[model samples]
Target: MEDALRRQQTERLVDHLERMGPGRVWRPVVDRDGTVLAEGGGPLPDNLEEYISGVDFAGKSVVDLGSNLGFYSFLAARRGARRVLGLDIDADAVLGARMLAALHGMGGVDFEVCDFLKTPPSIKADMVLAIDFIGRAVVAKGRLDQVLATVARLARREIVLTMRAVYPLEGLPPLEPGLRERYAKHISDGKFHAARYAAHALGHAWKGRTIHEGRVDGYVLKSVLVFSSNVAETWEEQGGSS
Candidate 1:
């Protein structure tokens, strides 16, 4: 009986891990009741622990923009976030998030139908998440800067931004100047967002100007811009910007 019980327990444990790590490139994480919590497009580029630790999501209140299926939002809740507000432009995504939250009996997380770019200036948050959802084009006429400034304003503590940059590295061929300009517009839009945040006192007073944090490995020459929400003198004391 003991041996059989041990085998059963092992099977159960294996089942749990399998459920937790579905191993799909981009799969919707559903609760026991089949409510979608999160979605990603490809196999996880990194492990859960490494991703969470790298992003530093512990105990923070997160604002997830373009939350798609709620993958990161659910992870935030599991990793000790006090509250997570998942916002997406799509009604379907919002419904999926709410269902997923219910499935897990997760109370501190909620979803809304709002554009991250249009989030009002009055709200301040610990973290703002805008992962690769800078959809469509970034440049056109005069609107590029306006778009970026909106992003900057939404972030009170830090902005976890993941958008393609304007320039390409050696391995990558040069995209047309127009394309580069478009990408550049996106970055500038984010900066514009920062400027608005600064202007409205939603974040630190405009500190000098924005700085590039260098390219993430996969992003190549395209840099990961780190815009701060604190005065320059206090940045180091405040744990640096992302």
Candidate 2:
């Protein structure tokens, strides 16, 4: 009963914040391990939790690429990361992350506004998070391989990458017609590189499955692709040059 009430309260708070603007509000949820942070959006999948928890950020530093609204970054700080830099190409996201840190009184967290994949190579972190980032940016730009290589170089210890996987390197979906017309010249001309890179990167042997789907203004679905830092041979070559 108490748990239900708490969730109801949190949902009410989320409603209030939604009315106000595009920021995040969260509440704590209690379980066997004590209180775990639960955002207004409700529970995330356990796979995501496992991925985030694998990064041993306790008393360490982290770089969050494509840190949308900063859900994971906040969780990392709560888990004892010494410093967390939330980087995003969107200025509003960066500001929102800063506001969230201040609102929660977590001073060690910071936000950076930059195209992180294009930022100076000197910036490094113990762990780098590229969750749901490559498909939106690199694949859209037909540069998936470059981005994956970059993710590896940016992290000293590990790179956490998640995106959709394409098999056969030929049967993948093309960019939607409207998006292709607005962003590029053609749709079915091999302009988007999701398939080729997946073939080269994973050799069609990596496991994959659907992860999330919902109606967000329009119905959309996304798959999760996880590539570990240990698999980035290109990044290893780049490291030798520096």
Count of clashes, each model? 14, 1
**Candidate whose lDDT is highest:** 2
TM-scores of the candidates in the order shown: 0.55, 0.55
Q: What TM-score does structure 2 among the candidates reach? A: 0.55
Candidate-wise lDDT, in order: 0.52, 0.53
| Model 2 stretches astray by more than 4 angstroms | 1-51, 167-242
Alpha-carbon lDDT of model 1: 0.52
Candidate 2 lDDT trough over 10 residues, lowest sum? 207-216
Clashes of 1: 14
What is the lDDT, from 0 to 100, of the residue 52 in candidate 1?
32
Q: What lDDT tens digits, residue by residue, belong to model 1 across residues 124-234? A: 668776654442243323333454566566666666554333312332344345644444432442332322222233234433222334333333321233344554543
For model 2, residues 86-182, the per-residue Cα lDDT tens digits are 8877765566556555545677888888775566346888777666565554554555656666666676665555554432224444544354444
Q: Supply candidate 2's per-residue lDDT for 116.
A: 57
Clashes of 2: 1
RMSD of each candidate relative to the true structure: 9.1, 9.5
